[model samples]
Target: MFTYEISPVFILMEEVVLRKMHSIIGWPEEDGDGIFCPGNNTMSNLYSVLLARFHLFPAVKTHGMSVIPRLALFTSEHSHYSIKKSAAVLGIGSENVIVIRRDERGKMISSELNSSIVAGLVPFYVSATAGTTVCGTFDPLNEIVDICEHHGLWIQNDAQWAALLLRTNQEVIHYHNRLQRAMCCSQGLLQECNQLCAEYLFQPDKHYDVSYDTGDKRIQCGRHIDVFKLAFEAQINHCLENAEYLYYKLKRTDFKLVFKGKVNKVNFFCCVFSNPATQREDVDFLIDEIACLACEL
Candidate 1:
């Protein structure tokens, strides 16, 4: 129901690079971004990396690597350069940022990582990509997290693009509820996706206290709850309720969706509304028709 356009750099960072954060219901900074970081951009979220490292070794603040031993950072080859950039800025030269090999599907090869660890590298941190760039594949977080925990390595999850998938799910679930209320006069097409509907997302749904979601208790500063919170949260939940709407909508229509409904999570939905009989005039007419229909309501 709402959209925001920040900047080319920030938007591109969110689309292709970084991710996460938020909490606290108190007085947040107003009128300026000075209040809180959306963490929707690369640079904004990268601050967490610096914070984690600094917290691990407080001396790194006043003294530059004088007290700490030789340290390295490991991340997947498919990961964004944001980690390396943070390293470079934090006095850990880019050379210390090791790139682990990834499999054909763009997932980090855990075996290769084991070999790297065996090769005598003292890693201070290991970043895992929950969702990757380019191929939109996800690295094996279970393996990566296990490795990092065993080695006392700080883990960072770049889950920016994954957040968008939450939106697609939200839209479908919301629309379907409206249809069930019989509010959609011409929405019989909504049922076309009943097969695609999913009762659960990747994990089985269980009734648990939601407070446990952010119980990590990391040194994260509270963010001003963005105005988009409630609606977007509803949209995120929509993923669970109406997972089939978009897939079935395009399947039953003349429009062809890129990727043909095959995506780990629907990130970039490139739709080609190509039709041999459609004319340039039809585009404007369709917009007019939609406007008139909206007015009819």
Candidate 2:
């Protein structure tokens, strides 16, 4: 029988570079925490801040959102519904969670966001996507951060698609793993990653001095530690590095802009459209032509 290792929710440790990375990213370096959730995926991470915010009043745990005034939250219309789910579960109600508009490429329209913020509602939090679901798009983090900072709003970036970097060469050069060989994420994603780390700094280990333990910086409470931590990081890096090549290759094709933007450093782009001038009738003819060509073979 294949034994299942039932590890705890999280391995209680923080990356040694967690704090230093935070400082460089421009986070406060004082008020942040990372956790590793055993079964926790994106929603758990989203729900965490809801719990923390309620804890701010300390009575909300017992009283719920009823104790506070009508608070509001914000997320992109194209974002994963987890934002709304978090709001509903937190007792904030889905209606109060404002869904911001996105531009043609699925990126959040920052100007529309700014307009919404001043629409007389007490907006407290704004959750942005690092890579959106449908188009694999990215929100404008720099613009979002500026708005959030100016409005005293808490900003959460859902980077489940691009959670952290994986310096493969330096970290996992000696390790061997199937998945680890995938992404060594390259340059394009650096901007998004840096902004997230800086704006949402995660530095909550008392030791805080310097240790390579990065387990604590995630949102999952009971985290499971990867024995080959550096190796795992390297693997992700490797994966992204390879993925960038595909982006380049695909961009070389004359595909239509299904999701227009620079090659995403995180998720793969799904280019599903052809040139605007291409006719549907031509597509049908091409399909038949391909069928005939296959038969000829």
Candidate 3:
């Protein structure tokens, strides 16, 4: 049987980075209490850490109160398997997960959610998937946020594949309109780099300054490089744009746009062609040809 290992140093580093980021982002609301450390990266570890934190504070141990051991973790059936998995990991019983039913088109059934919340199962947290994998449908975020607030539940927005909300103009207009259009993408990337530096820049209670002494809170020390190298030719590669153009061209024939956005990705429906008149191999060859030609340019 495989067992979880405890690494004091590694856990300390991870917690420090998480806390520092929380401070920088002003999230999870730092209350001056010491943070709990769980020495693993699996979904189980996440659940365990959260439960362990609740243990330290008995105020959250009641039914209607803050220390409720009972957690009604909410997510749609279309959401990732991790939701139910995390519940099981925390020993809350998978039945406690409370999977919200979806509509005919697969968006979460809001009425069912409303009924359930009114019944008072006492929800603790919700994980909303910004992009459902099988069909890629985004749930109504504003509506969901309102529901969560009414029930006093925390929300974790999952955006692994659908975090491109940074590209919209109406949203960015609140900060700066024409100027943001000029440098938003570049500025966003640079900001990510700067935030990382702030976390790992050899300061106490941060990453780079932890010593490797006996019983010290670190597994490894000395210089180690973690760098991501992108190809110099990445800019010249217009494969994504070419593919998108081809997608739009095909859509002009008979496809119906279902969900339209550049963030979570655009979804469309195309009727099945009766005759297999279009050569699949030829289409592949044409796309390859277009990519090669664009690269050469």
What TM-scores do the predictions have? 0.49, 0.58, 0.47
Q: Which digits, one per residue and each the tens of the lDDT, describe model 3 over residues 1-297?
A: 000122444445534543443343334433311222222123322433243324333344343233454557777888777667766755566798788887655677766776777454556766665556555566666667677777766555543224223221112111111111011111122222212222333344534334321122211222121101111123223333343455676566443445443322454433221122444554556656765786799
Q: Local error of candidate 2 at 258, Å?
A: 2.1
Better of 2 and 3 by lDDT: 2
- Tens-digit lDDT string for candidate 1 (1-297): 011121223333332211121101111223101111344435433554565566577666566677876678888888887778877876777898889988756789987876687545467777776556565566777777777777777666665455454333421221110110101111112122111223332122435432122211112322233323323554454443333443464466565454455543455433223233444455446545655786799
Q: lDDT per model, in order?
A: 0.48, 0.51, 0.43
The candidate with the higher TM-score, 2 or 3, is 2
User: Worst 10-residue stretch by lDDT in candidate 1?
Assistant: 175-184
lDDT winner: 2
Pairs of residues at least 3 apart in sequence or in different chains that clash in candidate 1: 169-238, 169-239, 170-235, 170-239
Best-to-worst ranking by TM-score: 2, 1, 3
Candidate 2 deviates by what RMSD?
Answer: 12.2
- Give the per-residue lDDT of model 2 (tens digit) for 1-297: 000122222222233333433333444544433323333234443544454354345566456567777778888988877677767766778898889988777899988888888756567878777656667676888788788888877666665454444232322111111011111112222122212232232343434431223322333323345323333554465455544543564466553334565434345435333133444455456545655786799
Any runs in candidate 1 off by more than 4 Å, and if so which?
A: 1-41, 119-121, 165-297
Give the distance in Å from residue 74's predicted Cα in candidate 2 to where it truly belongs.
0.5
User: What is the lDDT, from 0 to 100, of the residue 88 in candidate 2?
Assistant: 76
Error of 2 at 171 (Å): 15
Greater lDDT among 1 and 2 belongs to 2
